[model samples]
Target: MTSPPLSDLTVVKRAGRIAAVQASVALALVLLVVGGVVFAVYLRAQNRQIGAELRTLAMTADDANDPPPDMELALRENNGHISTSDGGEPGVPLLTGATGFSDIHANGREYRTLVVDRPEGRVVAMTDLAPYHAGRNRLLMALGFAELAGILASIAVVVLLSRRSVRPLANALALQRRFVADASHELRAPLTVLHTRAQMLAHRVGTADVRTLQKDADALVADTRALGDIVDDLLASATMAARKQARDRVDLSAVAMSVRDSMASYAHSIGVTVNLECESADGTAGFDVIGSAAALRRALTALVDNALGHVHHGGTVELRVRRDGAKVTATVADDGVGIDPDAMATLFTRFSHGAEHTTREGREPYGIGLALVREIADAHGGDIAVASKPGEGATFTLTLPAAPPA
Candidate 1:
């Protein structure tokens, strides 16, 4: 079976959660309403039966001298003596009251009683309700257990069905990731050859007597390098998107220095100054983080390149590394025109340029740089933060968990 795209994983899981909650709540409500109705009907029928038994006992005692088989009877004389069916006077108190039906407690047992005035004295008939009540209690207890079992069984089925339903989606995601990996690898070869040819052409123009073509050659070199950066970015993004890359202890300080050195020529061409700094003297200890070194280096390069685009000629862009406890940060700060407040929200989103399509350098911001940086940071279990105000320049900080002490 083909796997679902990775992008759908979040949607599938969210939909499952919402569906599970709604189904469980609805099931509980249905069980409560149905159980309540059933219990009410049973209670009403039981009450009617009890009332009928009481009436039968009353009718039997009103005619004959003895009580019915299921009833306890008491006959009182004019003076004080009372005769009872159980040969005990425990039910004598039941006859003292006036006529009509009532509940009585006698000899530690519950009874439904009726009293009628006779020619000689009063007659009281009572039917024990203890057995009926005991049966009802048992029935209610059983129903309660059954409801609990039903809820548990429903939850089990919900979980099983949900997993089965999302299985196809999960499979699609695996296939999509594999395709991205394959495509990136296939494209890398041609891009590398083109980049190398561009380098050679630019180098040949260094000794040629073509003074007028020098500007065009430089521009060609710059465009070719930009294309190479884009290719590397695409590959990095695709590979890191899967979050399956092998990781090792990466020194943010070293990554920063490498980015700074690689961009030195580009910064010179743009007439912008770039600086790299680290917290420690030798920068060997706390700058370490568990991540892919190449991905981190590319992320830092993107930041510096983005800053270079905003800053004017002679403006300074600073790349700094510092560690605090178990966390390390690499921040890129530029003294260029700061990011607009309105643009900050979508700054890292792909193809989300704020003001215009192109930066001050007249080059179109691919909008992929910051987006790729954010992706790489997240893949390494890190995060990116931005602080900027109009005209005050911008600062982008990438924070990661420091590697455990060796």
Candidate 2:
């Protein structure tokens, strides 16, 4: 069974795989951060350990009987001697050479300090917080490395998982492109034959028996032209998708009115009415801003033509044109039996005309709106969108961004 174009799971799946790249990037960044924090903790712990060793050595030096002037604190503290014993004097200094110590308590751990006195009455002290510092650092290093491992593992898993999405999407896109190329190719041969046959039979229009043949030939030519146009539209859309077209300044309002005029005539011939409301403004010399009179007219005409298809007699087809910023917008609306909400999701996909009256299945498809509208809009650096409900009317809006400011 053929699926609708817009929401093809294949495209979404490809898109989804591409999206996984971000997940990979995120995982790598997380690992980097975790690793950095872990390394930082290691350095901090090493610094604390060095401080502790220095203090211990200072205590050892104080034990020496005769020490250098700077080493006097280490000698005095090493001997554990003081002029007065503990509690002998309230204000008596315990060590001869040392400064005060700084201590802190954290996370169920106590950090202690020690002071030593030098012969010069200077004191030196070192905190015994090395154990607490070392333990926390070891914890961070372990956890941080674990985090990095998990991130790498996650990336491996994602790459494997995302392939499921990639293969199917690539297959589907290849299938659709091949189908379009084949169908368009096949139709061209028959259409060329029909066109040639019509021209050859043109002289027989007055003959009684040949008159019918001539009429049929003419009809064949007309139908073939339409078929050729459809093929052209499909090819154009593919071309635009493959290679970007340049953009230029386009006057949207004038274009809208012109297309409206054309559609109005077509409507009259088909016993319907079209209403046009267009407002023009002078704006920019922007980039990729293709709003020339002819192109905008074509875009508007495609929309009007699309609206006319599903529209009922006495129903109105309306068009409105407005300029915004550096870009322009044209909206075409119709009062008719609208589209199914579920179907709108794929409403603008290629080869998406209905299965009745137009295709080999004899269904009345609203033909080629997606292909032509997309081509026209895309060529002008713009886009088209549809809004519809089952019983309510449908609206197709075209939006083109203005050129970049010079």
Candidate 3:
């Protein structure tokens, strides 16, 4: 079992979301600053215009009898009597004691008032601010709507750009993971073979038989070449898309034999027996499928390795291949402490391991091997299944559609 790590795509997606939020905040701040500046300018202009109108009306108006629209004129006679154009509109307040502009709020209305002293008396000019205030309110509402719309548009643009920017990185991360997984899955058995053979060579080096030494040296060289071939295959596979890779007819029996041969030394070292059996309904010699040979071999190797891990020292692990109708099935069966019933559901899930099972090396399975096997099966238009009972052995069957007859 291979240990699962958090997916690279998931991490990238999180980063993209964070980027979008940050971008949105910055955009919102920009819109706020622009809106604030526009509103402030509008307020200053409105105040200046109102002040000019009040000054002109107070200086030029002859009497309170007739005044400009929206403006009210008040006259205080030398006799201490007051007169207004609106018959003393309640909304206007008299401020003859003050001789400067002032904001007056009365009778639930706003007015800008200007008071000036003259020879006859004092002149007070008042203008209603309702229209100006209404205009300001409308501008504020427009700014609010624009700000909201701008922020929403910024978020949408940021999200789209982030996804585009993150795509290449996501693909690179995926490729890296695939390379590591493929290399790790393919190299396990070969590395074990090399280790076992090296130990045998070291033991035989002190022997007097020259032929045995030569034989061990040759075996080591052959295993090293095989390891190199596996590395080359992994590199090629990693560079190409799985669906785009060339698929040829691969003999399942031959693949099982290869697994048996590769695991032979490791199995011997652990006192376990590796066996292979091939059967066909039509009495054919080979159970063939159309797929990547390296991928299929790795799938079979994972199964064999998993079987070897759980089986006892003297237990037997079998690789069985058979053709039924248009399907080719490869089953790896081992007689050892079986899988826990509770752990069966997640057996194929990445990073999921049985707490009760450990390999012959006394290490916990990494939990990804079987997951990779399931993926490989799916890539080749196939599927895998498992059966086990507590204290009994487990059997994994990998089923793939058989290649058409040539």
Candidate 4:
């Protein structure tokens, strides 16, 4: 079955997250700036109105002996004593400015005062700002609530809109998953039948007198087995793709040793030696990582199997697990004919022609095993690296983050 396009889902989700964050930050900045500007304008206008009223009162006190009603006014003679105005002390300190306004605190109250200089003396007209200040404070409180509500509303809208916009992508991902599952299910039965038939024919041919037919049957069996392996790899890939994040404390040393031991018989049959190497910092046999045990075992098995299949009859494949600070690494090295630099470039890619370089007699490299290993590593939030020389050997290393200490 062909691989469906599920990668687009990841791209869409990542891009959506970035865009939503940027939009939210931009919206917050815009609201804050606009609210600040409006508040500043209101404050300036309030100041202008109070100043104009105070100025009128000051001018009225300059023309007459009486002050405007409900307004506090003071007049000083040339010697700076209150002459005539609102009843006050005989010597009142009046501000010197003629047409300017200043704020003052008097009698536990805030006031805006305008000073005017007349031909006789100076006149001071004052108005309390406490009421205006209270109103402004209330307005600011309302605006603060409004700004907060707006930010929350914008976040809600962004979340809802982002989800709505990605509906099509989500649908596409669902369809792809279904397609892959169905296709793998459908192919499973036919591949099983073919393998059974090939095995039956090979068995029947073993008793035939025609030697040529026997040889042809052996080849047929090998090819059919290889095809079955390919199908199995495809099904495994599909299964892995469908799995969700399931992180647990996985013992890398155990997984590596288990994979090495499991592949021992196969390596012996192919005239290759498989070895396991593991060590802890304090000389223990445990190296912990955050991942699924089954998945890690499968990935290590694939690497070991790949290495064994490529090495020659007397070649050695070593599986090593080691812990380095906050990371654990599992490495598979084979002293077989090494990989070409050209082929090594695309070695881990799925179905790449470069991965099918060499194989043992009964084992064929389908170019899918390494790809599956890489996928498994990535799913566990790990990474794989390869190093090889044309004639020396190749090494595959899988690195995973160490689990936090218990």
The candidate that wins on lDDT is: 3
Minimum summed lDDT over a 10-residue window in model 3 is located at 233-242
Write one digit per residue (lDDT tens) for candidate 3, span 165-189. 9999999898788768755775787
Q: Which candidate is the best by TM-score?
A: 3
| lDDT of the structure predicted as candidate 3 | 0.83
Once superposed on the true structure, which residue ranges of model 3 sit more than 4 Å away at CA?
1-5, 77-82, 87-95, 225-406
Model 4, global lDDT: 0.76
* Predictions in order: lDDT: 0.77, 0.61, 0.83, 0.76
lDDT of 4 by residue, 157-233 (tens): 88778878887787878777765765555456556656776766667675757776666676666666666667777
**Per-model TM against the reference:** 0.50, 0.47, 0.53, 0.51
* Model 2 stretches with alpha carbons more than 4 Å out: 1-177, 181-214, 280-297, 324-327, 355-367, 375-381, 403-406
Better of 1 and 3 by TM-score: 3
210-266: candidate 1 lDDT, tens digit per residue: 764575566666666666666676666666666676589888898899899999987
User: What are the per-residue Cα lDDT tens digits for candidate 2 across 1-406?
Assistant: 9966764655677577676778888887877787778777777776676466647645554333443321222223234544322212211232442355544343443433345454543233323345656776777778777876887787878788787757767776777777666566656666676767676566666664766786677567556656665666556555555564445555566566667776676687666688977554654332235445554565677678767776777788888776666666778888876776766666776656532121122112424556667777766667888888766778988888865554
Q: Candidate order by lDDT, highest to lowest?
A: 3, 1, 4, 2
Q: Where does model 1 exceed 4 Å of error?
A: 1-218, 280-285, 356-360
Quick one: ranking by TM-score, best first?
3, 4, 1, 2
Error of 3 at 236 (Å): 9.5
